[model samples]
Target chain A: MSDVLAIAEHRRGELRDVSLEMVTAGRDLADQTGGDLHLAVISGDVDDYATQVNREGVDAIHTVEYGEEFNHDVYTQAIEQLYADLDPQYLLAPNSVNGMDYAPAVAEGLSLPLVTDAVDLEEDGGLTVTREQYGGKVETTIDVEEDHAAVTIRPAEWAQAEGDGDADIEAFDADIDESEIQSTVTGFEEVAGGDVDISEADFLISIGRGIDEEENITLIEALVEATDATLSSSRPIVDNGWLPANRQVGQSGKVVTPDVYIAIGISGAVQHVAGMKGADTIVAINTDPNAPIWDLADYGIEDDLFEVVPALIEEFGGDVPDV
Target chain B: MKILVTVKEVAEVEDEFEISGGDIAEQYLEYDLNEWDDYAVEEAVQISEAEDDVEVVTATIGPERAEETIRMALAKGADRAVRVWDDDIESAGKLDVETKAELLAGVVEEEDPDLVLTGVQAGDESNGATGVTLAEKIGFEWAAVVNQLDLDIEGGVANVHRELEGGVEELTEVESPAVLTIQSGINEPRYASLRGIRQAQSKPLDVKSLDDVGLSADDLESSLAQTDMYEPESEGDATVWSGDAEETAGQLAEFLRDKGVVEG
Candidate 1:
């Protein structure tokens, strides 16, 4: 049986939830392969992260106590060495932002085929990974041709592993190369603060790329004024400077759980959906009936947002602004 | 300073489309510069504009059809471009991260730019691994999902903000001669003006074959194969409000009020 080795991700002082989710994914793969599941937790309070991630199904936890924060060079070297030591058939890591930083490099260094953002994985004599393409419009299955491969799982796709288990916890000294450590994590900053915190709102009116031009935002503003709802938008609106960064709702922005999240023209990209999927009720307005937002929306209106938004404003006793 | 930005022409599917031959029907697919690459191009162009004697060059691994997209980058401010393509690449069929890294690494070896920038991922494939993989292949430092960049030419470093989940940005300092995969919304990409478009038509668009870039047909081999492709069955149970815009809006408003979110 080929063993499965997965990496645990930690940020600041906390072990991110994705690490536990990765354990579940790794356990599934190991079970299919009839191999042991080993975990590697590197950098940032390794002992605690190792102990925290020693959940059910994990057979061993390897802690590499290096620098205090994530340094890709150290991670790459540590993982490469760990792979040499263990020679596992499969390597799994989270597809989070930090995972994106190092997983590809690790795969490259190990001379393994790399598959990323895997939503589902299956092993039947061979490995088949299911992932989304074209902004989550379609799903595709990729067959890894090699005996050993590396994969990065999308966060939240797999359920987090629970229940404490007795797993072997040991520190593996990774040979950190000074020359390869070229990048340094200076610090972190929260850039999404402003007069409004969208996460705290109960009624929210969110817009997306379907709003078209910056000048057209006033129409939505009129609706927000009428309904007394906080105004927010998908990442594109904030990226286009049509709305403030504080009003952006997505994985890189705010996690909003409003009582009502009225998504106008938002196709609900996976990142955007991750933040607001917990809302009490969701409503989507878009002309494209195939938009992914409808999958999560409790109510949907497949019509032009321009006509419907103004109509929505009027219904709420608000005046529509002409652009 | 010279910057090499990797650009790709991505296929965006129409709202209602059919899948044929395990891929989106060609007729229903529209080609355009990848959204993330647009931002990368903008970041490179901005760096070139801010610095003296800095050249911004774009490199793409696509067929002749991608020249239109490369011209867009040139129109926006890239000095020139190099496109690596041949029958081998055309038939390679779904190049994996390693194969793509090998291809782009060939270009990086020839051009030898001090800095390399690419979109975090191609919109169509969305692998999000090419940049870092290429860095490993070519022995260059790299930072992924960079949303803000501050170049220290004298210090030989690139200070960047890596956008993380849940509204956090990790500030990092990367040693130069690095590849930075740019994220969208890092900067507002400007449209190509008429004058710029005219200039772009006359700009140098060097087309090369795999051998020209010091690569062979064997290097195009990928370790992954696509076995299936299809639209995921919708799990949505949304109550689609019918009638015209007004009627639908009325229904939505009523629903909101019934949920105690809005008032009459």
Candidate 2:
């Protein structure tokens, strides 16, 4: 079948927005290839999800159930069954922790060609996959040749799919031979303060290698507190152990799409840009006017972060919080 | 636990890249062990070094030139090394991450270590999917982008710390005999010292074909046929602004507000 198969991904009951984006990407590719569209959902409760993904122009929704929780073996087995059942020309999944887990295994298991982190797609089945090389400096594009390809899309790149078609939902029982299932999630670990993803932040004030010394972060921290912005940094800052990698914003770190992205003492590095470039508006404050950060910045302050930060704090009516 | 870490040999990131002849030139290219893969190997070594019960092993599937990659890892402290032994440049060039992952996965399935680790993503291919894929195929408990890992060999559990957006999520315990794809900065990878380099060449490595792992190249699908290679597009020079400190600050503020990114 020339139908484009799109997989829906969810966590903690919320359907990841990228799943919708995958539908958009899938639908576009389907249109380009003149193919039908099908969506697959694997979960303990596929009924609700089946209805959800159907709205995105899905002609049919295939649901497979397993444990109430996410088990890698269970999901991968479910996916393997779906691929065998549908035989769609292309399958799309988001390039995230979960997607990274399943897509490749499925690709490998079936001996299918897989191109991941695709930044763009072209008509006529030419998948222009944009991937970083050399620490995110260069993005290489490739045209894959496999007829049945599986791809994991990077988040925040594609526009979300929208439609009002709650099509037919069908329960799928791949009933994979349990012996083939390799891994099981014996448990799920929740981090200390609950799940707070930096990628989910609405406002972010990210620091970079341009900022000198650990103590200087208090200024940026002060600004963040003034505006309730999340505190984050680039790879170099984390590499130096000034901040934890969780707070890093770059290709090597979480991809952020905040309303306002403020960079202090950070010269824009490509690696860092990959994570935060999706912001609606970017603000870069560096003494170096020639910094690459300034190019993408909607607003640029070619001045010392030291002086500009405090004035913003004073004008914005706030002081640094005690950490 | 004799651990096996996989390293990739990719082109070096260049200062200035040119698009010549409609493709990237293979020569004058700089390559290193994929940074994330390096972390995976580094973490394995650190864990094994911590416990007396473990040994760190590394393997790579690339051309003869890839020997250097395995050697570099040895320099970083990997014990035994294997290169899946390739001399054909075109074959190596055509080998995709899926093929690499499948071969490594098959090999590991046979090696059967107590724990397996890989970088959550690679700097070169940047696919970030191979570890999970390999883990899935081999039937190992798989986790990705995990920032912290604590081995509980006594109970055969792995206490994993996963990084969410603004916070850290803890996976209290997962029964080991598991696969972990490490995110960058989980730990600082150790650089190989001169002493380690000399010892690496003497380490034991077994060379086998796809048959060794019960796999044939026929089992893999080459969907991502890299039709061509070329240097990436460049970011133009930045715009430099200069003036007095106070004056620049005022101009900057004005620019910010005017641009609507900041509201006065």
Candidate 3:
């Protein structure tokens, strides 16, 4: 009744960073509930992943060796069987792309109350999970009114667990039904490969939805030429086909560590920020003063990009294109 | 063959909005079709156009206001629409994944479509679990965060590209009668033309209650409750330049030169 079970995530035969972060989240919850923190690593080099994620404060590590990569069916079955055996008070999983794939199915199969993308979790009298909504404009706390529940922590929210620990590692035989497996992983592909890698840039001039029409993208291109900086954008630009996927920076895109990131007409959604927050100097040019980009910017200009961009281009002695 | 695409009318908060009673103030929120679901709707419409004898139906668990959004989908090209709502669902504030799955499962059973298409997540709550949860609830195969889908109707398999992190994509083959949560950028969604808008007015928009979908008030019960809602404290330490465009641009140019971002 007073135990926590956390599922670790890995991909392509390597452990993801979120696994260690979940360890930190699970250990905190275990301390609050006065319980032991147990971890389950399923699929693809399970023994190695289990040993790597065996951070301090973990009580036990359960290995369920399965397929090479993530198959939601396999994870769903393994986690369900593990849950029935352990009966932990709360189940923790990472809200990564793969986590979203299986966590919901597990919760539904087990008929437990589920919360996803939790940025904060606390246990006072009951479990309260804090999450961002309306695209990070506001925060809300949801109370789970059940003895047992499942939550998926947002990746990179908590610091990764450090140091080694002495924990018991055991192999859990997951009864996988071959007949029930409806999906098969055929192969993998690396996309967004092209002329330039945004991750290797020194300065990035990023654009977003605020650019509006597709024709207006040329205005930003002029800035890129004038400043000799690389051109990147938030998700919308790539989604609109105005830019290629390789030129996008975000969670599903590329993580960039530029010396300067000039975010023009881009509101810093959490997903977009995850890619470029490591910039040495951040500048935001947006019309809306309340845009979230200001939170991350070292210098902000609450003005329209249409007016400021041309002037900046002229200052850099670059040709300004007529839109 | 039929494809059921799930759509939602989500609220986008204004730049400056107020929070009241664990929710955003009604006046400050603008309702529109969710960004992700727009792509899902476009994918369904495109598939319907490409194949023969295919019907594209959309389902929504929203109130009367959402019909405007449903009509937008119809204008873009869904065959018809089914909306499930009642007093019980209206009062079910902040629905959890299980509750949403149960509600949508009833619709899935009634429709019995060959393929289910839904957005990766709604823009408002961003739960991102209802599609897959509903798939599990109805005992169907599913793939999440799918950016590319190639459906082979004769073979009864859909080859999909699930967008993973760090610019990697995992390819999978999902059995037909599967639920696919569509990601953005799969295809360019078409804008609703005036002719399409006029035609959508006469399209079949069916409204149903929980009983219509073989459910009851008990199914709306959820274990999760929103206890509090508020604006997150701003952590902005930005040095904002207060001036017109030219002055601010000059200040920015100077700063860039100082940081060696651009040569002076």
lDDT tens readout by residue for model 2, B175-197:
66787888777788887888888
DockQ of each: 0.89, 0.36, 0.87
**Cα lDDT of model 3 by residue, B178-259, tens digit:** 9999999999999999999999999999998999989888888888998999888888999998788889999999998998
> Model 1, range B123-164, lDDT digits (tens) per residue?
899999999999999999999999999999999999999999
lDDT of candidate 1 at residue A61, scale 0 to 100:
92
What local lDDT does model 3 show for residue A313?
A: 92
lDDT (Cα, 0-100) at A15 in candidate 2: 73
Off by over 4 Å in 3: none
Error of 1 at B141 (Å): 0.5
Model 1, span A1-323: residue lDDT tens = 38999999888899999999999999999999999999999988888999899999999999998889888999999999999999899999899999999999999888888999999999988899999998888999999988899999999999999999799999998888888789998899999997998999999999999999999999999999888999999999998887889998988999999999999999999999999999998989988888899889998899999989889999988888897
Q: Chain A: TM-score in each candidate? A: 0.99, 0.76, 0.99
Q: Is candidate 2 or candidate 3 better by lDDT?
A: 3
